[model samples]
Target: MTNHTVRPRSAGALAAVLAATALVTLGAAAPASASGPACPTDTIIDGSRLASISPECSFAGDQVNVGGVVMSIPNPGASVRASSAVAAGYQDVPDVVVYRAGNGGVAAVAGDQEFGSEGTLAALRSENSAVAASARPSAVSTLDSAPVVPGCDDRTAYKLSGEKWAGAYEWSYNNTGSPVTSGVARIQDALDTVTGGVTRCGSDVDLTATHRYLGTSTNSVDVTKAGGCSEGDDRSTIGWGELSSKYLATTCSWSQDGIIVSSDIKFNNRAPWWDNTGRACQGKTYDLQGTATHEAGHVFGLDHVAPATHQVMKPASDPCEYSQEKLGAGDAEGLKRLYG
Candidate 1:
């Protein structure tokens, strides 16, 4: 058996704003208290080749290996044909699995193998055949299509009122224009400029929202780590001060009578590695305000900023100087696509 890597372009992949390592764990749309839904196992396809596979740390802290290998079964959405094309009615079946590319590899075993309908077998194979095993596999299901991303669908807009922004943070965040408090205001101001001072999307569309908050002193679960922002070498040479472990990233969705939007998260502290002049670790510090502005875009469902720069949504920050705090033309276009 041979392992083939699959790499299909996600509708949301282009809009993903966080680093490749960052996992934007928004508050589930079901409710803040809602328990995570079990990974569905309905569309298990048997007799497929191991096309692509990735490892993901589940919410339960268990490591789940998801694969995008080939399947003998037809893709759920498309007309059965030799040519690969996603079907008309088929939304991708989330959490599907392909087997390891080796002898004695099992066929369609439950839990071990999850399934996604990649239009056609050939298309799925073509898109993913070269995916590397080392890359962290993202969720196969429509996690990207979730109604609640940071910048999608005017989700973050509703949270931008002076009151809403002020309320989400601690008392210390109230200073007039101090670097920290002022950073918070600048982020809000940028959002206000982009959204035209509107807090809600009047029509049915992708919504976005963003806000700032103080972080915990320390926690095993931190956004900076989960989003893989602090661990990479890019941050070290970029001259960010330090990475704070307490920073949090969360997205929440709400839908009862057809209301949907989500918020983004950003941190405002330094990483311990920032002080180490010897370049001990691959770390970076950032302008809390600027990073927040970018992460906010993501929570609202925006991807990374194209033509990357010091702009809010760019994956890596430039050296110590935080210049591009304002949203750029690309940022505005993304916001409009999601909302306006």
Candidate 2:
């Protein structure tokens, strides 16, 4: 199995990183269960000395399965959003294998983790197939109450893939431990900017669906800053952390019966960001507020449309671009279908 786990950092730094997310993850380094992996002891016979056994085993270490399974992110986009439907059978759910990350993030697996025997690797492949959605504010010091990203600027045509928040859900922010270019305030403003009307793209329209900001929290995030999602926490958190070199940001979501219940957002700590406020990107930096605005659209259940369509939910944001800070008519219309 490929060890894609993020390398560990200093104890203090790792704690700070772990404190920022709450997307259904297990505490690191939990002691092994007395009987071992939660499989039925009688499965094929405990007489084989494999100890206890059961379906859906929750390993003490690394909550994500570390078998040879490698899930790849889609192309042309830096971030990936992993989602699954809750079901009785694990096979019924699709688990997104997290790519390996770097230091200052979660533990990255580097080799095969032996549990019982190599023969059992296939069975363990399905274990820990979940993502964390936890969070807390880290280094963002200011909260820009004013709208940072403008709305109604895009003129591109787009269509909706159709998923959304039911009624009104709430979300929180977690900082990067060390302040990034943007502060918590500006991030909030960017998020709020997504819900209203799109007023300038030749087709002015109103999107009435709404969500409340719950302020900042220390909840561990679903996707660690190191580039993977912890499974099963039901909170929607936003925070900063190290991601794979390819990603600028990532979001993890889970739902049941076709309704979204949990979602978390993690901005890549390694990426250059502009708050669209005091600090600006050097040669080419991502507009923090704009990226945030787009991620919020995903938290609200918007799927990515191609960038050519010009919707805020497109997979990629332009470098130093601010257009994504607001919703396009297509973006709003999609939300309208979900919550309207």
Candidate 3:
């Protein structure tokens, strides 16, 4: 199906206002737990490695068992549409983290790092709850508007605080256990819509960025079945897998120094995926294109606003709402700020 939306204009003004708001809010927010038994000072001193370690490792011995990628998670919110717990809301886990362990030591869990996790993630959330609450919306982008759109104020959006595609990310597809009825074309179209050169509402929006599909991949996505990040083949992959009930699909991205290095998109095998955009929205079944479009936004560095805000970037999905296949005015505007 074709994508369409209201034409987008510059949201630089709104972005600036929201950014300034964040600066002030963070400055005033209380500090999260820094040192304690859960995270002793001897281990990177801040417990950044808590989420990826196993029970036996004692937060130091196991070390996520990945290739030197030490992860630290701290978000007191169940969020980004994918927020909450690894059990109830795996989306709360941060999709990207600072990749500077060698020189920077266990990267001091950035107060601004929106996504975070550590195994069960319960401790991480409580540890940072006050700080996270304090940093809530000091201001948001409401300058751009198209009330006809789902999120009436397309400006109600946010992007990953750090790391975006420094170049066009050539990704691969994996369909080993997909539940998509429409087959590969439908999924491919979704990927293309997100990468760049999409038209909305007969209006061409500047949604171009570096998200490309390099054909099918033999590897599975690095996202865990529980909806947390995992160390996989290191290939940027988009494919099918088991995800928690809360997510239509889960995305995990890896970055190095403010540049997106790789990412994985996993469509839930449990979801009854309907790919025919021409058809009406169905019960329980979600639009593959629409939902995947949102997951792709996360891959390309978009963050979730609130669901009530009503943009594609909202953290929750409404079954059968195919309009999400196209970037809303706010979605486009956010991309413009990052990629343009």
Candidate 4:
């Protein structure tokens, strides 16, 4: 499988706040126990030895099975979030894709990865025999819409399918070698804040974390540490999340499969703008919970709101500001529209 890497937008003021560092590449393959059933030979990529094994197999090198389909990545050690949507009978034919974005908030490539050979209409009919014959045409024509936060520029949104997650989603932190002291707790709190805010929309969709450990690798959200002080200097953005791209048409919701937060930036829970006189006008630490909350919003469906402070989805976060930790009116409205 061929891999493509796109650079995210530049980090502006964040550069002044934290020192820069080289990007850490993550490419370890998932163990053999993680492999699923073997797939047909035709489904494998050309010129790759992966055709001999199960589609779920993660090769010794940079190749790994994402949602039962093999994918190649630039950095084998980078965390991956893989998801798939398959029709019946063609259990071997998986409509899946893997996506990755730099630290900057730029969007992920939509049509970059290839799935498989384009089969004839008769082949589709035969493959989906279990599906209602009458519904076959619609199924064939239906294309999953790209999973993207609604308000950001089209360029920065991750090109994934809008696959809504069911029930309360779980999240865990991989803080090994992380610089932040309370990284796990702080990020969990931020996720909770965002989930609670969206719940106010009266939607059934929610997020919860019962454990901090990385358990069975399925659809759970994994919050990992990134090596960057500013958004684009060290990495591409302050943080970015990956979602499944094959299930977009079923629902307009995209399951936030993974997130990476930069450790180079300074963050604190203290309120912003407090003076030396103990008055509220002179503090400078960015709110960690607030930043997490913003990133969580992206995991959901909200995008960056312009003018900086109109809502939690603002494109750029101001240092020492906590207004985004809570959902704004616009944020609530977006959730209601998507989930309600």
Which is better, 1 or 4, measured by TM-score?
Answer: 4
How many pairs collide in each candidate, listed in order?
A: 57, 55, 21, 24
Top of the candidates by lDDT: 3
Per-residue lDDT for 27 in model 4?
27
TM-score of each: 0.33, 0.55, 0.62, 0.37
lDDT of 1 by residue, 1-340 (tens): 1232222122232233222314322211111112221221212222332222111101111111223322222112111000010111222222122222222122232223433323333333432332222122222121124224333222222111000121122211222212232444554544444344122122222233333444322222111222221111111011112222333222111111111222223242333212213333233443443444444454343443322222344444433323334454344444444343
lDDT of 3 by residue, 1-340 (tens): 0122211112332243334444322112111222211222122222334332222212222122122223322122211122211222333443333222221122223234422243233333342343333332423234333456555444445544444666787887777987655646776776677666352433434444755568876876766665656444558877887776766777766655345567777777787778884567678667777777777777776776665555566666666777778776566666656665
Q: Deviation in angstroms for 109 in model 2? A: 23
Per-model root-mean-square deviation over C-alphas: 19.7, 15.4, 16.0, 18.0
**TM-score quality measure for candidate 2:** 0.55
Q: State in Å the error of residue 207, model 1.
A: 10
Model 3 misplaced regions, further than 4 Å = 1-100, 107-146, 197-202, 277-280
Q: Which ranges of candidate 2 are over 4 A from the true structure?
A: 1-162, 202-204, 225-227
Number of the top candidate by TM-score? Answer: 3
Ranked candidates, highest TM-score first: 3, 2, 4, 1
